[model samples]
Target chain A: MISLAGRDILHAWGKFVFTGVGLGLLIGVTLTMAGVYRGMVDDAKALLDNSGADLWVVQKDTLGPYAESSSIYDDVYRGILGMPGVERAANVTYLTMQVRRGESDVRAMVVGVVPGGPGEPGQPGYLVAGRRITRGHYEAVADIATGFQLGEQIQIRRNLYTVVGLTRRMVSSSGDPMVFIPLKDAQEAQFLKDNDAIVQQRRRTAENPAFNRPGVPGLLNAAIASQSANPYVNAVLVQIEPGYSPDDVAEPIRRWKRLQVYTREQMEKILVGKLIATSARQIGMFLVILAIVSAAIVAFIIYTLTLGKVREIAVLKLIGTRNRTIAFMILQQAVGLGVIGFVVGKISATFWAPIFPKYVLLEPGDAARGFVAVVVICVLASVLAIRAALKVDPAEAIGG
Target chain B: MLTKGIRINGLKKRYGKGETAVDALKGVDMQVAPGEVVGLIGPSGSGKSTLLKCLGAVIEPTAGQMTLGDEVIYDDGWKISDLRALRRDKIGFVFQAPYLIPFLDVTDNIALLPMLAGHPNNESRQRALELLKALDVAHRARAMPSHLSGGEQQRVAIARALINRPPVILADEPTAPLDSERALAVIRILNQMARQYETAVIVVTHDEKIVPTFRRIYHIRDGRTNEEAGEGRAFE
Candidate 1:
């Protein structure tokens, strides 16, 4: 039998093509929304992966470092390094703030790591350009996403650091690019008050008589020096020995060190399941709304197309056309529209993904699911048109 | 005696119920033989459309016996199990406006009926082409309905009606949209197709120009039919 739907589409292909283009743009936005959610999860994983840590040691009883604020003494990692199954542990601090470059500033996750080589757990794994930081102060390794080049100088808070290296995909859980500075600079940046406030604090400390005894002449100066410096870090990144499991090492640190310890799996859960869970739900709500809107648009378009052919449909029915044939014709047209829209949508999403501010990871698996979903939606959307076509009376063809 | 063409005995149809009931077709009796074309003429309120719908099996009759060939299709109630199949295989229809499917070309429009009845695609198109040639529309076989002239479209419509070779064809105002010459041409094509296919035809029209071409005509007034003689073969 001749395909009634195909012939109709060919006869008015301009209409179908234009409508499909419009619907395809909507599908593209829907796909991009899903990709955004995927990108958030990937960024969180990349943050953990690039840190090169087998475990996270933070302040006791806190989620810390990524999802919450964590403060521990700067000397904590030294104690953790001597434990059995502990290959290496390094002090690390994270502070999300805008870093200035020349005239403009870019949002970045300012990380503080010891002036260690590539093997350190908290240091950036590899640099795409220039050398890793070998200087103890005022040297930085910046993620390429921060738009910093080799030898470029950037200001972290009160001090300026030279961007000595650049790495890729080194971002925080929030998708901000990481700018690696020396541990001491980050401690002062995160904890120390301004110079004016420090001077005022020192003056106040001297006025207190408790530390001003005549027998202890240098005691007040020592107390003032201590008050002017910062001695805290955010967390310690630990790497277990090759023969040992992360849980095996992490448990001892939790008990003996009296600090919160998280294995790799637990940290992943904290980042994905807890940190970005709300964003995932928000994206999910947008997906549901987009799906409903797509379904409704398809239904309206199909229903309108069917009504336009009411006269032909009545004549078909009068000429002994079966209800199923009429219904199938409408269904074929709807699915055809969906197929065209999906092709355009996939192409549109691919072309525009890179230009987005954050990474938009369009996985093949998501495309497959989106195609199936579009087909199912088209089938369901055709129901209203099919019902209307089936209800047409053959007698309408022979009017009184 | 019952004929092998088509005959209706005491056909009746009503609309609504109780006080709002309407007896549109009080009782319609008519006969058209194979190899013959007859006209059904009436005023606006007459039962011509009502009887045409009944004969086409598009609407059920209140009480009647409708026969096609040697089969009693309706006796008070329908005797056929599948009315749709009966309509597809045993009857054909033409409408006032040609009403060809606009999406399809001339050939597929004519061939659609036989295809719907499960005929092979090549065979149906072959039959359709032969009818198109016979109706002098073979040159426009691939043209879509929208591209065809009114007279050409009507000829295609006639080819479509005859494509399935059904025993009976009910044409409602098949030439109403045409001028005098095209109208006569349509009536001539109907007569030729009816005789060539051995199918009976009943045309419902108010066109005075082509009314005299029929050898027999049925004039319906107030749900009753009166047989009259036409000026037969007045085409020349």
Candidate 2:
């Protein structure tokens, strides 16, 4: 027998196509939402990967230098370097701030890395363009996402640094691009007072009778010098030797060094499980709402389409058409509409993902699952229309 | 009782109970032999629709005996298990509006009956094509129902009814929507199709133009039927 549903769709293809297009846009937004969540997770992972460290040593009783604020002495990595299985250890600081270039400000994670060549922990892994920072002060390596070009000067706090290199995918867990500068400069930018404050502090010390009894002349200057310097770093990035497991290197740092040490897996848990957990839930709520709206739209559309064919259904019933046959026809039409919508949605997501400010990763697995979900949703949504169609009395066709 | 065509004996259909009891068909009795065309005429609410519904198996009679050909289909209770299948195979129906499946072309609309009865697609189409040819609508076989004129759609409906070669056909005001000329033409086609397929046809109509074409007519009033001879005018 000819396909009753196919013929009906062809008969009114303009309406079907228009409805499909409308549904497709909704599906596109849903896919994009999912991609945004995926991008967050990916950024978190990229932050960890670009660090080139198997273990992270932060202040005790803290979650991270990423998820939360953490501070360790700038010299703490010296002890970690002597530990067993320790290959290299470097201090790093992370501060999310708006760095200025020309007139516009780019929100980025300001990273302070210890002076090191390529392949060092806490340094950008590779550069996409230009060269990595060779000098310790007023030189910066910025992620391409920061919209910073090489040889351009950007202001971070009171210091102006030239962007010497551009890296790709180096971002904080929050998806802010990372701007790398020397560890000493970042420490001063993070904690050191301004020139006015330092001068005022020195004058205040000179007027103090406790230090100027005419007996401790050098003592006041020595105290002032200590206050002028910043000796704290956010965290110590530890690189383990080839033969050492992350857990092995991290345990000793936590035990003897008396600091919170997180392995790669533990850090990932902190980033994904704690840092962005609420955002993921928010997106999940959006997904649920979108699904409900999608199902409602499908149900309403299918119901209206079936209503238009009430006479046809009545005639089919009067002519001894089985209830299942009529139900199947409506069901097939709904699924066909979903299939078309899914194709359009996939294309729309792919076309628009790159334009988003944050990285948007649309995985194939998500697309496949979305397709199945669309089909299942369409099938379920068609139930209302099917019930309405089946309730149509065959006697209606023979009108009084 | 002769074992052929359609027979109805003492058929009754009453709605509600006690004070609200309204009898639509009270002891309706009628019979039509194979290849015979009978007309059922009645005034509004005179139980013509009730009797037609009972004969079409759309509504069950309160107490009655209904036979199609050699089968006893209804005797107070349904003898056949699936009334839908019985309707598809043993009875054909042509409504006033033709009621063709609008999405289907003329050929599939007519072929659907035989296809539903388990005939192969090609064979059903072949049978439908032959019937369309007989009804003089063969040229419009592939045309959609919407594309066909009223006369063409009516002819396709006649072809659909005769495709199964059923022994009985129930036509409810088959020519009510047509003008006099088209009305007479539809009745003439029904007559020719009935004789050609050796099927009995019962046409319930109010069209006076086509009423006299039947050899025998049944007049119903106040839930009762009386058989009478028609003028049986020759067709043009």
lDDT of 1 at A314: 94
Q: Write the per-residue lDDT of candidate 2 for residues A64-146, one digit (tens) a residue.
A: 78888898898989999999999999999998899999888999999999767888999998889988878889999999988
- Among all windows of 10 consecutive residues in model 1 chain A, the one with the lowest summed lDDT is A190-199
- The residue-by-residue lDDT of candidate 1 on A1-400, one tens digit each, is 8888999999999999999998999899899999999999999999999889999999998999899999999898999999999999999999999999988999999999999889898899998999999988999999999999999999988899998999999998878999999999998888668778887988888899987777887999998878767788989999999999988998889999999998889999999999999999999999999999999999999999999999999989888888999999999999999999999899999999999989888999999999999999999999999999998888888867
In model 2, state the lDDT of residue B65.
Answer: 92
Question: Each model's C-alpha lDDT?
Answer: 0.91, 0.89
Alpha-carbon shift of residue B227 in model 2 (angstroms): 1.1
Q: DockQ for each candidate? A: 0.78, 0.59
- Candidate 2, chain B, TM-score (2 decimals): 0.97
Q: For candidate 2, lDDT tens digit of each residue in B9-59?
A: 888899889999999988888999888899999999999888877787777
Best by TM-score: 1
Q: What's each prediction's TM-score?
A: 0.98, 0.97
